[model samples]
Target chain A: MDHSSKRGDRPGVSRRDFLRGTGAAATAVASLVKVPGVEAQEAKSGADVVAIGPGPVKLSLEVNGTTMTTNVEPRVTLLDALRNYLDVTGCKKVCDRGTCGACTVMVDGKPIYSCTMLALEAEGKKIRTAESLIDGGKLDPVPAAFVACDAQQCGFCTPGFVVAMRAVLDANPKATPAEVEKGLAGNICRCGTYEQMRHAIEDLCKAGGK
Target chain B: MDNFVYYRPKTAEAAVGLLDAKWGTAELLAGGTDLVSLQKQYIARPKKVISLSQVQGLDQIEQSRGWPMTFKIGAGVKLATLAASSALRGSAAALAQAAEEIAGPQIRNMATLGGSLCQRNRCWYFRDEQSPCLLKGGDKCFALDGENRYHAIFTQGRKCVIASPSTVATPLMVLGAIAQVLSPKGKREIPLAEFFKAPTGPEDREHVLAPDEMLLSVSFSIASDKVKSASYEVRQKLSSDWPLVQASVAFELDGGTAKNVRIALGHVAPVPMLSAEAAKAIEGKPINEETAAAAGEAATSGAKPLSQNGYKVRLLAVAVKRALLTAAGAKKYWEV
Candidate 1:
């Protein structure tokens, strides 16, 4: 599958720039104060103290081995920053809350729900999305096992399942079927494809034995 | 979620300084797992948010050597680290087990110890934005007459009937943990038992923390070799659902008799309920099917179950019985 072609659907103008243009128009109607030098005042009290805005602020994130920059409000979640702004939409936002793992991504080599984390908190950390599971235009072994067992139906939750499976294998290459099931407990599939997913786990364990 | 000014402070003092003296002006952000959802639902609308992620040394778990070993776990320590720490597994196995059973893998990776303990109650009425519940400064608690299958069984007439949501609080209370709090005035230690309280009024919180105060860390002594500790939880589903009922037990085994027994029950009361009667039933007696069952019965002595939550009373007793037997290293009666 040509996964890179999914990026073609994004708009040319970023969401941050569009929001900034609209925000300036809204500010003209209601005069909101945008205080400058707030960072400097906080820095004087402590070396590492820094303050940002109620408006859009610049954030630099390292995603999938590339440093990307965007302007977002502090209320924006990492999943929104990735899917809407950065044009990396492999991680699905099925349940915006932390319950479902459809928005799962690896931050600092640990799988976490992207919707539950603020984009500003991800600064200076290594982030890996589901798109990174493809190596040189080829699917990784974990995703390949899913294909062999036909583990997905609607395919909305495939990316998260693949990424979580890869993380489990990366941490322990010889992980058993039961261990993989426990590690992937955070994810859910409304299509009720868990029986096929169990077959995929058995196939992955068999392949790992070689 | 509404827009708010974000501040990342380097030190604990600076973080507390940014907080307002009045409630709901400024809020602390630990892992953003619970706070973000609360903000999205408009349940918490803080004007200023203080992020504690940048603070140094708040994520470390250190063990101090002494006559009786002690452990100081920073509030920022993630639940994943607590569940997998070999030191905690050997010293406090019940705490590790409780941490492992909470939520799921992704949530455990993002949730911190302090955030889990300070999380709001999960009653459906309180969580609904449109409902005028008592916890949200409304006139009456809807859970009393509405659908209340998950409401508290031991409200003690406090008005709100939401059960305490922290799974780790049960084990922490049994282990005699102390919460170290930091404020603009100074630092003070509050015992874990006194740290939790039921909300009395509309402006009350589930914990005893003031708006300007932040939980710095939690300290507890390691259990000796003679101490046997265990935690058991009953849940509807093993994947990410909250526990229906849970119990944590710790006791010293002197020859064949149990002594100094401590019992704590969760998800049945407004706070982590410590049962003195349950402890008395098993004290100075050999842990067997009869004594364990008696202790379990005593744990539910004062429970006044609501209209739809009468099943929780029996589940709480079974949980206490199983936890006691597991701590004593006895046979698995339920398995047979």
Candidate 2:
């Protein structure tokens, strides 16, 4: 809904000039083909908020097997909604920058970072988190293995890894140590629990007996 | 973090038209991996945010007779999807490998090749609001004498010390591809090799596209002859984080001897750079350990790492060697 990422208006220096002249000689020949897909935008600028049709709307998100509804700003990130509004605090907020996988969640059977995802972007989609690891006070195997294998030290990054490992294990129960490592590469354990995490996933495969 | 208006355009023109109306103040959001980081670091605070996610036909990755023997990947295509794709996983495996190695699955899910290529510098000075690096038009580049490890040695000049962050473009450079852009004015298709810019300028620009333009898609036409390609990346670890160094090697075999060797180095220069001289050094050689080792040496022969990043120079060599083996149909890493 916002195009702020396209502007090179950083502080001090004007990156617009830097980004333009850097790639010269190649962009000389150009053509424009107008194919309509996006909503017809009002041809105006400098407005702080542009409401194309309807104003702000209330919505519901079924997170961690619970239907939670709230009024969300267009700019609200899923992480912000989960942390500040809904209080589903299992997803850690470390490295609020998208580089860290501390806020990973599953939407429609695929894993994606909630931090980078806009709150409204994932509307009506299935959302899962580390909070879903326990069923009726029973620990899920992947998470149970994480605790048994001591795959966590601080417990902050553990939830992110558990969600990611669940996705990997769902697809490949016998995923090798390398596969496990690659699968969880997005999830970072600051306490250096990599070896234990690998063992945890390996133990899950062993228990599956496949 | 500046207060801004955000708009979502569902098509290439809608995205371009939004850029046209808010030309100077608008920013494009594809994956937000680079832009969000830049915003957090206060490097870019665009007044307007336009989304390319809902744009149809721009996210398609398929082969059709309308285009040549090619892969048409939409600009909004996610890196994770590209990595997991079986067709891409095999034929254009190097690009897939590079895509998979970026940040992590979540980042790959959000990050796109088009966004990664057009992203701003990951340099600390450029990103941090505190520093006034030359790329920001300040006098001193901190990487000149400061913590210069990840900065470029090959394309470094007096202005900037940042390295290009796209792992996808390195393999694209080897694949003989072109990037298509649509703006309010018109559309233009530029060769992938010429789309990037050097940082050795007072203006400090990176790509050839105008400020009001949005990337439509990147078109890949196969090479003139049969060329096997692979890409190798060296990172601190496997994750969504950027790579420390990357190399893409495409080898054309003339039955026995190598011909038309194309070697491009990423994170070692200001742009997704091709070392033609380095590639020429082993143009007619075989893909044996000896030849690949030699090509690796040539890839770094004239490389000048920043004072602290000497390890990257050798790191790139290993990547080149492994990529050469992969390009030569080395069937070991694909077992899984």
Candidate 3:
């Protein structure tokens, strides 16, 4: 007799639900399980929550000391997520097969190929991309030295070199020529700017990586 | 690359459980340095991926003090970390050198010991995804007759012409390393020799790991006080390239003579090739250029080279000689 009044008294019940009927309401609740590629545990919370997805899933990442949230498909690499979704395009994508160091980024203080790493795998780590090198409108010592020494000609590979060089110098402050050679061996410049790259790194080493 | 579901399990048991649940449709993801490339090439297209990145505490390098000192290298430890580990560098120098010589710094930064060992063959035909090589369940092996340069010289009587691609496997074999594998059913340990299996047929993988199993860690006894070891790889480019041939020598020295020795060659066979003949040649002999040359000659005694890769036989010999000389602290040949 007063079904609408009783439904209203029940908190969180929608006014539109009365017109749609309870069958539609039940269907809406049941649709949550229809999410494709998601495991049953995705509905649960805590460590038990296993988000297996080809579909989009929300992720919280600590990037360059900033907490950023983004939704990404499980198949999306960290490099793609950073460049496409988060607008962190400083990391270049080249030889996306993990061969070229063009997509190098620091995950948990260690340089890793971002193109080969899934964004979901880097969920709890501190990710530092090449974009993090700039401070107060000034370039980091390594990138500044790259410019001063003309380490880049085509300039497409500059960002990866800069990020990798930062890791090298941070790991070894007074790196020798051999050490620097081994350290920078990961990144390549097809323009044959390696001599200049080494010179720029030597300059940074001399400047104490300020 | 084909889209797929990804699972990041925090524990080894959970990871194994996921693999068990997914069964034939899942692939374990570690490092992704090689797996991503395989995926990009469509060589590996698993419907579900189980990422081991969340499995913590599997990255430690511990050296236990025993009668024969043992070193346990976690499967999750990066190749770069292993290469730079002072503990490993001091005790297991060959392993460190092999780790350092793998690919380049960026690849090593993302590669792990288990991933390197479990990596599929680098045969171009097999990796093409369209070549329909015998290793991929095709009727014929393209590498057997087409561009057979990088194909194995000693294929261990298998139809597949692919050679083992693991640089670490060579040194680990010489060191007598054991792999601790964990499965949903239980755990098991396999020696490096048994861990890598030569492809017997079209459907055979490079290793014998089951779909539900994962390599947990690798353990090796430290080289004794009487032994000296070294790893030598003859890569095309010093920058970042696969080796044409790699050799690792572990020599037990008595005064200046080799009491006993173990030598293993890589890229010359389907598995890391241990040359018992080479080891026998130099046993009870003085560590000199002559003995080293004899051992080198012995290493290539039975090599059946493919048309384009006959040069690999000479390279393998030279690698063995140089590796032995280096391990014995003798003057290295081929310096010029």
Candidate 4:
């Protein structure tokens, strides 16, 4: 409302006015702002920084048991980083928008969405993708139980769901189908495999998450 | 596809410096669950992406010493990590449940706590991956007149209709959590409820985060044992989804009577909707079905839901009652 501010009679304080007023105010307020990095230095220890390229980043993954690393584009997801860069294509890439769990992987023994992960951050970190579930080309007991319980259909979302179920079974060793459903609730099988997946976890419970 | 620069800093100060240097043009990339997807969809085409993944200790979850003894969670902590965290198991169990319900394991692994709290809206028109919606500096907020089934009910009159995308923070707000932010200028803390901004006027910012600021971490204290909490999500399905309506309650108990109750409902409102009226309904009273139902009714009082989302009223009511009853010790360990 102040015509003295010639920034076209700006509705609020124009950028120029903001600078005039808050420039002085910013200094006093600035000191009150807490930079916690100095006090909380222990949080980030031995951090690694890899340049995500004009192309891809130089990414490495000790997936399952195989230690693999490669250069990938900055836009590449961990799912794509594995499939295209390292050829550990066990984790699928369906519904790349994250509604589906087709790109589930394990980082440092915890479940994560591979499609949403950046490959550069995986450097020096232990990661286990869905491909790790198979030993010497043999599927894991959970996956075998999946076959027994008929947990999958079409096999597109199978690898991702398998890895997700693996994390669940690992976290809750003696889970009921109800717990399995809750743990794996983040995953989606467009083919309506929820019932079978539940049964498979139940079968695993019978066999002791083996 | 234009080239975008990515910087991964291991500390909050470094991220703050990077953000302050660039100011309004730059963005802090956490979890990449939303930022990267937005990039892929071409919704947010920032020139600089300051990644919080490497920020040294932003991913930690620890308990702090105090009179009430608070638990602090770093911003870079993952949803899956939060869900499986032993620290939040009893006091903030609703937050843990919400964290678990965000997406599938894949996205949870990559998405950080701050990212989900600070993530942009998922409105279809806004995320067209092509069309210039209102949030992208476009003139008309497509949700104003477009398909707005998922739009907000409480605060959105027509300007910005994007529902907040955070699954954990809503519960945090109900539990009265505090967010700590760091900037090149310094640091500031605000209540979780006050952190999110109402998109009423022309300014399109979703949260109160300064252009030069970065969310360093969040900490809040609860009764730990007396406060019982739970999250209720009405998703289309167990996995393939975000909840249609999510409600969480953190209630203090006194000989089966609710005391100092906190109620928060998400997805149905623009930001996390806190109901003082709902809280008062159960405060100093026995948490019975009638009272829980009344609390639910009070929570959803005066809902201005959109055409398709009128269903949220009932859904939120159920969730509120369930959460309240659960928090008041009516149920334990969720009948799973």
| DockQ of all models, two decimals each | 0.51, 0.19, 0.34, 0.20
Query: What value of lDDT does candidate 3 attain over all alpha carbons?
Result: 0.81
List model 3 lDDT by residue over B14-97, tens digit each: 888777443336788888988888888888877678888878777878788754778888898899888988877766778998
Considering every candidate listed, which one attains the maximal TM-score?
Answer: 1
Write model 4 residue lDDT over B13-122, tens digit each, in one string: 66666564433356788778787777777766665566776668888898865446588899888887898887677667888878877766667767888888888777
Per-residue lDDT tens digits for candidate 1, residues B213-315, read 9999998885576777889999999769999999999888889999999999998888987899999999999999899999999999999999999999999
Displacement of residue A192 (Cα, Å) in model 3 is: 1.1
Q: What TM-score, to 2 decimals, does candidate 1 have?
A: 0.92
- Give candidate 1 regions above 4 Å deviation: A1-48
Better of 1 and 3 by TM-score: 1
Q: Could you give the candidate ranking by DockQ, starting with the highest?
A: 1, 3, 4, 2
Off by over 4 Å in 3: A1-49, B20-24, B200-202, B333-336
Q: List per-prediction Cα lDDT, in the order shown.
A: 0.86, 0.73, 0.81, 0.73
Higher-lDDT candidate of 1 and 3: 1
lDDT of 1 at B334: 82
Docking class of 2: incorrect
State every prediction's TM-score relative to the real structure.
0.92, 0.83, 0.89, 0.83
Candidate 3: lDDT of A151? 87
State which candidate has the highest lDDT. Answer: 1
lDDT of 2 by residue, B1-336 (tens): 433446666557767666644223667888777776666666775556776666778777976443235887888888888888887665667778777777766777677878977877678877778887776658877887898889886843445767887788899898877888886778888899999886643354567777778787887765433567888887785455568888997766778777878899999888888988769878887787777777888888778777898898888888888888877876555238
